[model samples]
Target chain A: MQMEATIAQSVSEKVKTSGAEAVIRSLLAEKVDLLFGYPGGAIMPVYDALFHYQQALKHVLTRHEQGAIHAAQGYARATGKVGVVMATSGPGATNLITGIADAMIDSTPLVCITGQVGSHLLGTDAFQETDIISISMPCTKWNFQVTKAEEIPAALAKAFYIAQSGRPGPVLIDITKDAQFGEVEFEYSPCQNVRSYKPEPPINPEAIEQAAELINSAKRPFVLFGQGVILGQAEEEFKSFIEKTGIPAASTLLGLSALPTDHPLNVGMLGMHGNYGPNKLTNECDVLIAIGMRFDDRVTGDLSRYAVQAKVIHLDIDPSEINKNVKVQVPVLGNCKETLKHLTQAVKRKSHQAWLEQFRAYDQIEHEQVIEPELKPLGPELTMGEVIRQVNELARGEAILVTDVGQHQMVACRYTHFKQTKSNITSGGLGTMGFCLPAALGAKLGTPDREVVAVIGDGGFQMTLQELGTIFQTKAAVKIIILNNSFLGMVRQWQQLFFDKRYSSTEMVNPDFVKIAEGYGIKGRSIKQRSQLKEAVAEMLDHKESYLLEVHVGKEDNVFPMVPTGASVSDVRLS
Target chain B: MCKDFTITVFTEDHIGLLNRITSVFTRRHLNIESLNTSESQIPGIHRFTIVLNTTEEIVQKIVLQLEKQVEVIKAVYHLDEETVFQEITLFKVSVEQAAQHNLVERLIRDKNARILSVEQDFMIIEKTGHKAENDDLLEFLRPFGLIDYVKSGRVSLIKPDEELKNLHELVNEAKQANNNQSFN
Candidate 1:
């Protein structure tokens, strides 16, 4: 019995494993439960290894490489975990470029693994070879190419650490096929530190004190927050800071849902199609405190005229974002969760009742001129705003709303109500057109208990309609609403106003979307009349499985509260 | 507003870091006039010297973006007045022409250039100076049948005390802290 035990122990200690198996083992060690990927020639070995480990790690086969990466992004945004994706070399890796760029600009955390050609075949233009390392360098926070099996574990660990750390972004690791086939003694150790990469900068107490003094003395202090709050898991800290200061808060498009929609201090969204109060009051505020949000061009219409009167206090984890667009009086550099706590303790509480009333007055004007007419239109033609209103009423501010880019996306961001953080997901920075369908599928998988709804446009829905097959196969209960306008609505709106009503290539004759859904073995409904809207959305929400609901709305409807291309934010029009 | 600026980056030696550093400039459509890379006094650390002509505002932004790279320890930019820098240029001339003209030898002596090599067919001259000085020497040598001309990128040192030594100590401390935490 002793000799038998000795033999078994020695055998277990020196067992050899392939790099493909090592990749799976490393993922399991990282506690990665799900992956979005598609099988291909170069990546076949990893897929083969994945088959035996199916019970521990679940793989969702997406229809395309772009779909896989977007789905991974959705998963990351929904769960605040690093999303994982895999694809083959050459065309497969090239297809993921758009999503990588989208993730980079939006600060989504993802680790994408691509299979490369054999090390010997590199630079020889072998069948499926491409230099993905160079192609992905600008977009990725960091990336590495592994030509040996021994390098797999360390590369993956670093990829995950870099991807999900401070100011999170996407990272890529390209593993050669020969490495996947080679053998090694597989052991896993998670990366805890990279000497040159400091994920979090040291908090400066003096900067926080300066910011608080500005907040305490201001007559009208306005707070602008973004996805950084959600990404940092600092929603509670942000709420405490705003509540303590009694400051009015506005959200950028990506920052929506970081603060509850119905919070008393919450004003509305800010951008080209943002609310009347936030855009106009931006110029009126005496002190502007921007937290965990970069000043994107869409939010600041013309940098020269944006908030020139205000003393800006910017809080961000990234130092580069401080003076990139607008100069700030006090720069607080650290995680918002930590910096907000310090600021909350340092500030003095005082209500700006008169300043608050200014925003309320602007809100009243916007409501009468824009909101009331769009949500409860007197005309026979239905508007995109009303569809979102009905969905909001049914979902009760609890569902996860994923939107594609277009007029419908703007309408959804403007109208959707959220009671929770991380509940509103969209392609904010990159404004990717086909992001909604696959992203919703990944979000649903990430949080299976939540009601997931994908709000898409007629134009954007056709961009990745094949994802319906993924929903059909997985039986994920995602509610899809297509506000079909039979035109590329946002562009058509711009063409109408800016291009002398020349429709150009904006008009689209779409396919039978509901029929396509049915062909995928999922139930769906189509509606054109205003009367059927409420009941149809309710049915979609109550369905036990995946359902598609297409609502045909006004073809030339424009997203309003306009800040035309070069106009100042204060000059936003409500017509 | 556009003037010469020198950017120095200290980083760990890692594969593909150079590409990551250069792409930051390419993304902004900024032209890099010269670039030099070498090992620093500190072991295992590398230094990159890049010279560009841009506004102070844009150069500051580029420096911040460079430090954002994972392997980069620190990135700092200095105006020409704040730094002492030089470029080395090598000129190859036909030996026949050099011996035929006393002006070539007189010009080399006047310009503080030294003869690096004297072969039967070709003569090589080396000069270390600023860009304008090198250009002047090239102009003087062109009439003497200059066969080939090559100039190295600008290599620079900040006029102030060495800040990187202090930064290197801090980096080591942080790495030590990381190691201690991992043990727990």
Candidate 2:
């Protein structure tokens, strides 16, 4: 790590008087190591001043603003720091939207800056002009349009800070061309008064005590962990609490990587694609303790029917998220780790043999019943469900897996064993179609130390298939497994159930994925035989650059044991 | 089919842009409506409009989605005849229509529509005004009527009063508060 102690000063001395320069300098002051960007007319001033911090900032030039954003997401995920991306006005600003929305949905930390046509041309529809601030309103955690040049430094500084704090998500800074071009004497001072956002920091004593008391009181309590645990780095305390109380625990997609997959107390995922023990227990248990996880609809099918048998104790850093969805019997509004620590001292573990026996028996029966293979044909004859199990077995708890939207995603959620938060990245609320590939890039960027695998369906892979070039350019150590069923698999599956297999436009036939992967300068392979999967995965993971392994599975395959839309957990059908 | 026939209002410094125009279109409840409002250039010019969907539901939904932005001030699919209206449209007619086109060319000549271009198929015409102008013009040019036309919806300005001024101030105040909250 080459230290840039003087680079910050060099930037401050040179660009301090200029608005765009001040913005660039503030970013450097915040110790931003990388930025992804595409430059144009309105944003030229920012790019020009960006020259000074070249030593400190590693700027990745992406072909499109969307690519810039996704790459930034990759950078953020890899470094566990806030990602940064910049773009010029109009289309450039709009292009960054999908990526920003993705981060919002998955709760990733990102800072996006877009240039607006000068303040004078604000709503004129001037060539290349867009109302960037208003357009990005709902998609971002916060957004601004800096009309005055003097606002740039503070705006950039605040954008960076807000993006990194409190249930982190994307923030946007839209500076007019005038702002970027204006000159201003800049004095760098730490931003101290953010009046609008007062995040209740992770430090509530009494709530922690009550949470601990509830945890110790219930022998069958289970922790439904999510991404906040990973964001807060609360896994250690999470592990400690589980060990102390001997409580069974499961995780949401975002919370997958927070704990070790091999940990004995680890139950599994609980949701539409949830596994036997976790899913069953979620609806069966008396004490359901959810930590650092929002009760997303995907995770809790038919909210009215979810955890009906359970008394909920919800712990999260975000107060908005606490009672937004699932009502909490015990609300611990603090960081998971801090809250858990307080509980360890405030409460004692209990020995309830009857409750433990009840959970164990249910787990045993369901595991046996659910894991039995239901067959379909395409060589290896592996259903989407089978792939999740195999991936789980082979991973044996070390790989960081990501998935695209559809049945395969759900099956992976149900069958794959996840142990940590922020480990799994998928479009949860957004349910974005072409999320896996780019997001896998983000995930690999987030955790370069871990083996990153993205499980995508044939349809999802095709949506943003243009990103193969990005993966190759970065040489990201990502192994993408394409579950080629030749259909918009999930939609097709739904039609199969709801519309009498009308199929409509759901069916699709894809080109050779391996060939397509190879076309982009990455290693590629296709596996149709069951025996080929394990070795192919091993070889693909070993590749220096990104690799694509396409597995041709059955098109008729649908994620089974499904509780259709508006259906309760008891309405689950296994066919 | 829930297609919307919109009326865009661009008015002079009026005391009641909304009251007069809206009451006209809405009073009869002639049709369900959708409306939108925003400030346009030529300072103090406010854009007020209505969307009446008697056509495709999807387009209506798409327009409704577009109306969701906060800066849009007001956007809804609740339209009726009692709504006030003003609109500008640019249409293209065939050069062939010049020789013997009926009441259409006559109207085109009256509105002083500039013929943008004329090809083997037809010609391009540009016009601006009230809905009757467009309708009477459309009836006249019905023979060699259109290639394509884009109309800006109604835009109405409120009389500069305590209320509208306060709204502008409130908007700035909200923006300031949001900006302050975000930086922290």
Candidate 3:
């Protein structure tokens, strides 16, 4: 670490007196080595200060503010460090909100610094000004407005600490123009405490003991792992516990990479649109030890009827998550790693051979027979399952998969087997669209050496298509596949199930993706028929720079055998 | 981890404050082993306390939560055992006819306590503040005979730090700047 000498303790040290300089100084003290952002008038102060610190920090200019925030998320998710992004006030700030909420829901540690209109004009409905603090409150771990330049240091430092500390989440610090321009002696030290925030720790000893007792007592013991295990770095410990107890494990989409997909005990995914055996096992298991995974509607249809036969033991890091959705008979709150360690010590091996045999038999039967009648003529020349299988083959057990929200995400969930948790990134809780393009850019940037593929639907890719410019600008080689069916796949599937197939505004008009990619000065290809799928995917694979591979699939298709909402687990509708 | 804490709060439990209060107890890494909340008849007021263990930062965070609660009028957190004040409970005893007369005036003069009820069997006395003070008075009043007593839990407060750099100076500067900008 450079011993920065006699750093400006007060405003006088700035070669330029502005809040922007203080922001730079604060960031420097916080040892912020990199920043992701887009420039604008409202954020000029930040840029001005940033110029002086070029030697100390690196900056990546995203094509849009939204891209910048997702890049930050990618940075955070990959490194488990606090991701930071900067943007101009108004639309710039608003643009970053979805990404901010995305990080919030996923509990990634992200710090977003946005420019704000000056204090005098705050509440007057000033042009290009949004009440970012109020707007981001529910979506942030905490939100603040630094109306004064002097508070900038503390606020930013506090933002980083809170973001990286206990049960990390996104935090926003809105700096007003005056504060950005104003100068003060900048002192950067983390705030030891913030009044309004309190993150719960892992469950206490008694609770852990009771949880272990339940696990030990069950004849058909199984674990439903979620992203929390990844966040807690409990993969090794989790494997250890399961090895000792011989529990069959299934992962939520976010927990895909936690266990190697090929493990015998690994049931690929459970719930609607998942592997039949796993979903059945999930329903029939006597005890469902759900770790870190919330009972998202997609994962657990009909909360009342979800795993009705089983006694669920819920373990999560957040107290609000314990009973907020699915009611669990045993609620254990704590870090997933810590809680798993306690369980490993407290539990003993028990046999569930009869239970295991039943599931295995079902697995063989389901694997041999068609789970659902193979997608017929209208169901597209290629099923999502086939695409994932080919993609995984091309992936060579390496490249991280980034997905946007929709049926494709489900297809990816049931289809791909991950080697580690967090290897699969998606908008889990906040299922935001237009999420993949930028998030892939961020992920590729975070891991430039590794190949990264963004598996996206037509509806989502359009939301952030502007990012092709960012890819061209940065020359980030991220391979993206537009699962183009000319409709919002998930909503269409919903309509097919719930709304009488009255597809309202779900169909998307045609766009020449190749031309769009060309407009951004990148390579693009279009696949119109089944014979073209491999060729398009091959072209994307060998492309030297970012490529947009548009695969035209059928529009009438649905991710079938889906357990419709409000339907019991045992009542899944498989045609 | 084994965490322990001793805290006392002075406040009014406004609607929804109890949840806000306990929410902190649950949210922060504290395991509330025991919690007590009861009426303080000083109009819309109540006293609540929690015992738990956690880091100093978490405890201060809880204090900040208490201060932020809309219903909590005031909050005090004390850690030291000896240097805080607590309410003194009262005890009454049967007095022999001869000892009763002297005891009444003696208790009143020494402890500044008042006798609320008097009967051949016993007199009810009330004393407030330090436990030691109440004990001294109870001894004199016990001439009748020892009865029963209740001492409220120890409520403690560490003296607030003397103001160093004015924390509100920034607010004042912002105010002045606002005024100047408005004038322009």
Candidate 4:
């Protein structure tokens, strides 16, 4: 340790470094390998410094700033590390707003660095200058601006710490141009503690005891978890706790892959368009143990009627989230791993076979009414579920599945199977349409050994279709599957069901996605008929390089088992 | 349900924290009527007083959201009757009006305002009072040649019994926490 310290000191003294160089050194100190960014005038100095550190780090030049940030989110989601994104001020910074907001609501950890105009020109409305810190304030977990060269390392350390710590979310650091170019006596020390911030608040022993006692005494217990399980990297802990108690577990869309989809205890997804059983049984469960899931409005439709019969025990790391929505009878404020461990130790070993069987009965009903028909449709028009079904079989439920937001995202989340943890990534809260392509690129890069597949809708695919250039440059082996229905299917479905079929602007006339893939120097296949689905998907998956498979799905198909707008979760439709 | 609500927040002086704090109002679609920020008596601590027109429910939610901010020490909302507050208004008027008529002097006497400066082009007058009193003085001075006018947001102090002890305790705890940390 002394020798390493001496070496670090000598290295710092050898280089009379600018703040840009300090930024690179700090990132290296933090051991960040991959960076997604775009270059502009304000951030050019950092890019210049980045050129020197190219040997040690990998910088992915995405087509747009949004792509860069989303890709960083993908990297973070895949690696459970802080994703790093760099962009210039104004337009470059503003372009990251959607991604930042997406990462914020979805709890993706990202460290975004934006370059600002000189500090002296901040308020004068200098060229290409925008109040990025102010603009990103609501969306970021923590954000700071550094004008002095000496503050660069500390700001960056804090940014990374805040981004990755406690219910992880995006954090932004705005660096002034003068600071980037100004020289400083560089010394990098990682941020350990923030006086005003407490990432992990102390856990309440009484809450855990009450939770355990409730779980033990319950005649019918249920477990509903979400991305918090994945965020805490507590899949093993959660599995142990659930298996010990024999509680039926339902996952939020973001929590899909935290446990094996095929696991007997893993009930199904819980929300609109979710499995029939979880939504129906939510009202009947006696003791609902919600772990690491914020009861989003989508999950708790008609909040007054949601889980009203049950006594809820919610274990989460964020204290503010405890009673923000659904009331919790026992609020265990801690990370899922710690809270579950404590609860598991005290909980009585019991099985609720009767309660578990009720979920299976619901699953049977959904399978016959919705799942079977969607996965094996009789109509001439192919379905998104069939395509996902084929991908599920070919990928053997092991591939990392990334989906853009829309009908396809829901379809993928509903149908795709994952045998391992961290295999599912999507924009759940923000519902950003163009998240898949760039995110897939980052996912493939982050987990290069694993099979990476991106499921997107034609509408969403076109939103960030420009990232094909990124794929062409990086040669990422991400299998792109576009469920092309030639319309905004989700919106079209809502119109069909709720808006008196006012189609209006929901229709779309798209180009040949195959031709577009060909133009980007990627192999492509198109399947228009149901008969051609298996062969085309097989061919796309078998191809050596990156491949795009466009499956023409039914245009007017509506996602079923949906709780109608402002309706109770128990009122899910099977149509 | 829509009535004026004042929210006071104690926090550390972190750059862009004001933006982060204000963004909560923006996200909830609540309009900020007035905002004032200044250093607190406790060293290294800052306080922000934000006024908005919102329902009791929305104000409660806003305070909760504000307290969730990493830099924010504490946040609470107050009704009109709960706090003793004042806004300082500076009225700049044409010098000719002050010289010609005793109207300016008489108004100043009646309003309990003091002349800040007498310039060649304009004379500056300062008034400290509740928002209504300041507005009333402005209305009376409207007949006079007014050059410019500015009013600060409500600088509020909570009633002794209503003042939060938790905030002061939290600030002290934060200081103690920082002192124990050896990272610096």
The candidate that wins on TM-score is 1
lDDT of model 3 at residue A363?
Answer: 64
- In order, the Cα lDDT scores of the candidates are 0.90, 0.69, 0.73, 0.89
Top candidate by DockQ: 1
What TM-score does chain A of each model score against the native chain A? Answer: 0.97, 0.91, 0.92, 0.98
The C-alpha RMSD of each candidate to the native structure, in angstroms, is: 3.1, 11.7, 12.7, 3.8
Docking class of 2: incorrect
lDDT of 1 by residue, B55-164 (tens): 99999899989999988888899888888999999999998888888755585669989888888899889999999999999998898899999999999988767765
Across A355-465, the per-residue lDDT of candidate 2 in tens digits comes to: 556656756665555555542233447677666666666766567777888977887766666655455666776787777787677667556788888899999888778
DockQ of prediction 4 = 0.35
Q: Considering just chain B, what TM-score does every model have?
A: 0.90, 0.48, 0.47, 0.92
lDDT of 1 by residue, A1-575 (tens): 65334233323343467999878877877888899988888888899988977877899999999999999999999999999999999989999999999999999999999999999999999998899999999999989898888888778888888899999999999999999999877666678788777888999999988998889899989999999999889999999998888899999998999999999999999989999999999998999999889999999999999999999999999998989999989999999999999999999977877888898999999999999999999988899999998999899989999999989999998999889999999999999999999999999999999999999998999999999999888898999999999999999999999999999998898889989999999899999889999899999999999999999998878888999999999999887
| Alpha carbon deviation, residue A495, candidate 4 (Å) | 2.0
lDDT of 3 by residue, A1-575 (tens): 23244243432343444678778776776667777999887899789778766766667898889888988887677656678899998999999998998997788989899999988898899888988876776567766778887777777777776787667889888988888878765555655544323354546888888888888889887788888888888889888888878888888777788888887678667767766666766778888999888778878877877777888888887655665566678888888788888888999976566776776786666555443333223454666656666677777757788899898888776667677556787888888888888888888877788778898998898888888888888898989888888899889888887899999999999688889999999888877676676666777887878988877776776775567777766666555
Candidate order by lDDT, highest to lowest?
1, 4, 3, 2
lDDT of 4 by residue, A193-262 (tens): 7877777878889998999999999988999999999999999999999999999999999999999999
TM-scores for all predictions = 0.97, 0.73, 0.74, 0.90
